[model samples]
Target: MRFLSPDFNFWIWLQHLDTPDNNLNIPFEFTEANMRQVKEILSHYPSNYKQSAVIALLDLAQQQHGGWLPVAAMNKIAQILGVPNIRVYEVATFYSMFNRQKVGKYHFLVCGTTPCMLRGARDIEQALLEHLKVKRNEVTKDALFSVGEMECMGCCVNAPMIAVADYTKGAEGFTYNYYEDLTPKRVVEIVEMLRRGETPPVGPQDSSRIRSGPSGGNTTLLSDPKPPPFRDLASC
Candidate 1:
């Protein structure tokens, strides 16, 4: 979201004041089944508060559009929710979770927060960029992969983790694999496996690391202790 030029940044901020653009001529629709789902979502709220379901409805639209929210999708959501098109646009732009632009089949959201960074998140990021031959937020030429940094994935114990979202597979079979406790070399191998259409073992990349436990073996509480015999209250 950072711009090098101050003037361009100001201009970009001005776009927020303008109405959401629906210039794209593409048609967007909610199918009968999805419409039923939308209705069910709306039913949870009162008639006056139906607009509360805007977020969920937009999510459905994004899923239907294959993981990216196109301008046309926002238009459809605005119409369905009986709100101004700019309202939906505001929510979409405010949220980092929503992908306004296109993403590759596998969107790698690598955690680069404090824990991950301290444990070598930069190495993992560099490896991914080199392997994909593209910079952050840029998709590969084949549109198979894209990489981006996230604040945290709540996997601090398994620092340097990434969530691989598979959009190539349809929503029904969509899968997100979290590859954790990564190294630069291991990440490269994982991406190569993905490129070959092979599933890589998820979770900790190290064979010795168990979940978030210490590498190799458990050091603390290494021995099992016998339970103390119960004392009878009558004896006291």
Candidate 2:
């Protein structure tokens, strides 16, 4: 349930380098528009409590710049919140939702917890890796997909479930789709749909399944229960 162990400190030293990492590796910074959002987030707290908005600001920064938290973004947030840069780093690293490195357009996060593992999460993950031709946390050559592991997503009944995160530009901001009750074959099909730039159906992949309810059909609740006779009020 882990990806490549990211350096977690790459950004701290980038500022001291004589030359830029590369043309595409530009320093991270919040845009003027994003700064306005940061101000709004900070406004939720008192002037003396700007640090309270650190988590919210970091999320905004990540959304504004693809799906990862760059060092420069954290530094900018630290300055605005009037806290040490390390504080921002702590929050970023503590949360798995915040990616330190860039992710592909679609991040296929499979649950690798006990319940999921018992249900075939490993096979699902292997299918994804093979279909995408990338190891865990590695982006595909085309940058279309990246595979990773996640803890239980509270969908244990759905045992093997995947949370597909889409960072591609669209009318709406980011969109997350969950496909539950999946098999290895179905998982690959889902990836193929994304590769074709098509939206796959979200939720349970099986038509017979309903949410996390009994698969196939409702066997226990087949008959409606009759109301019980009410006791006389005087008996009380």
Candidate that would win on lDDT = 1
Superposed Cα deviation of residue 50, candidate 2 (Å): 0.7
Q: On residues 136-159, what C-alpha lDDT tens digit does candidate 1 reach at each position? A: 776789989988766788888888
Return the TM-score for each candidate structure.
Answer: 0.78, 0.80
RMSD, candidate 2, Å: 6.0
Clashes of 1: 0
Model 2, backbone clash pairs (residues 3+ apart or across chains), number: 0
Worst 10 residues of 1 by lDDT: 1-10
> What does each candidate score in C-alpha RMSD?
5.9, 6.0
Cα displacement (angstroms), candidate 1, residue 167, comes to 1.0
Q: Among these predicted structures, which one has the highest TM-score?
A: 2
